[model samples]
Target: MDAETNQSRQSALGDLALVVGTLVAVKQSVLPFTIVYAGPVSTFSAMIVATFLLYRRGLNWAALGLRKPDSWWRTLGLCVVVFLAFVGAAAGFGAIADIFFEDVGASGRFDFVKGNLPGYLLIMALVWTHGSFFEELLFRAFVITKASTVLGGGRGATLAAVLLAAVFFGYRHYYYQGMHGALVTGGIGLVFGLIYIWFGKRNIWPLVLVHGLVNSISQTQRFLGA
Candidate 1:
């Protein structure tokens, strides 16, 4: 490569490094306060920040897969099919694990519904809106996009980004769900990461919907006292 091309690539990477560093600092400093004081609105702050960063970087919503697809119905249908498949797979794994571990995850996951309408509705709303929205944008879009820049885009880079981000995604859940839930969440994150990569990392709507649906179904189970 020519010096000019190499120089340009380095300059771009430097800019990305700066942006990512600032975001890390901001998250470290601000997230705890938001978690304590903002409740569900913690993610609202993240959404706002992500939007501003995207704008400043001259990135459109297309960066996060907000484009017109060939068929919207096809996208939605695919999401539904993927969601069901994941649930079925998870159930099978849980059953097999149960044989040896005997209720391996019984105490690790969240009970979202709480046996009440208002509380259940609130939890569902948060999962569908903030949790799915901010999480997809944060992890699949921003984190993966920025980190993948270092390795450059290729099959190897995509795989590396997916594995790295998926592990961190599982770590994100470790506090609330413990080890068993963290591992399960990490597996889910790997699938979502692959979906993001498959779509050229330009669209994560399907992943968002799948995540929201999983949380919704879990809440429904809890509501039914299962």
Candidate 2:
């Protein structure tokens, strides 16, 4: 292989390692350290490692699909579409899970926000940063891009990358959301992945907006006891 191909593979391998390391750390410490703390800690740590890796290649966050959109209005429209699709997907998947599982429990971690003004406010305050931006950056952009590259970079590889990333994204929530939640979230991830590519992989703003909307609605429902 040429030097360029070799370097690309090596970088992809580094990204894989980064992802695995972060997941391991989160999984190991989540129970004892708590996701509230462990989540951000692992996320930022992975961000740091990712940044360093990008620096080595003289790239930036933009390389991980954070480019400016061609049209703001188009992105906004896409966000609305994606948000509705997510709601439908979640409901459909939840129904499917119900057929097999007796109790598909919710994520208990956010239970403290239910009917609690301060907790709700705090979570809402960090919703964009913690729930939307970072999650998309890690699970969608970073994982899909690197995974596709690692899989040798083709149309089929990209689809497989999306599937793999979606599964991992779902697994990340299993610690708190149980199997049902994981499956639902995984379905959501698949939607996000497909849209991420369909809307143009270079721009992630639409996905971020959609994710923020989902989190905001969920948080509001919890706050209002819905």
Candidate 3:
């Protein structure tokens, strides 16, 4: 195939895979299963399909922005910035959500960890694997890359992709968190998405680290009842 034709074919496959993954997520969310099981089912199902699609195009996780950074120090610095941005965004959006709701809805899902050392420890173990790594891979890496490509691969496309992915990311939390949680989480997603584009979309390690840090802190707060 010619270059243009090959590119077109790849785009088509990406679109298909994106749609399939999204549908799977939506279906899983509404199923009778609990969030603990449903969340992983949706995430892993989408990830498996995404991986298969990428392999068909001779691409892999690296193509979805999973590569290592050139400098650990620089990446660590970026992680700090992203983490601060996450806090700012969460607080800002949370304030806005408070205006419409009595309080910004907290996910009761994590209440099990409140003042429970064992529960906190259990979730902390999964924070890196399920929360940080896979979530970023699916949301930031896969969603933004495929969305940007489908939208025509430019700055505007990337921004739009970020917004679209942020909304989806936020909605995924809606099963456990109400609209307030979705809004706050969505804002955080926007921050992460923008940072992914700003850093040239070559490395997701920084975001992954920041994500883990955020989850860890949140879990710790629950453990301490802070």
Error of 3 at 154 (Å): 1.7
Candidate 2 residue lDDT tens string, 1-226: 7899878978897877887687567556765857555666666667777777777778787876688878889888877888788888889888886777545465567888888999988888778876788788878887888888888888999999999989988887777778888888898899889887786367789888888888899889988988
The TM-score leader among the candidates is 2
Model 1 Cα lDDT, one tens digit per residue, 1-226: 6676566456546644554455455555665664322323544665666667678768855766866667778888878766865676566545544454433343423344557788677777888876677777766776666556655666787688788778877766554456665666677777777778777255567777787877787778877788
Model 2 earns a TM-score of 0.91
Candidate ranking under lDDT, highest first, comes to 2, 3, 1
Ranking by TM-score: 2, 3, 1
Please say which candidate is ahead in TM-score: 2 or 3. 2
Error of model 2, residue 154, in angstroms: 0.4
lDDT of 3 at 134: 76
- CA deviation > 4 Å runs, candidate 3: 1-31
**Model 3, 111-156: lDDT tens per residue?**
8888888888888978877789878988888788887776667789
TM per model?
0.75, 0.91, 0.87
Q: Assess candidate 1 and give its TM-score to the true structure.
A: 0.75
Our model 3 lands, by Cα RMSD against the true structure, at 2.8
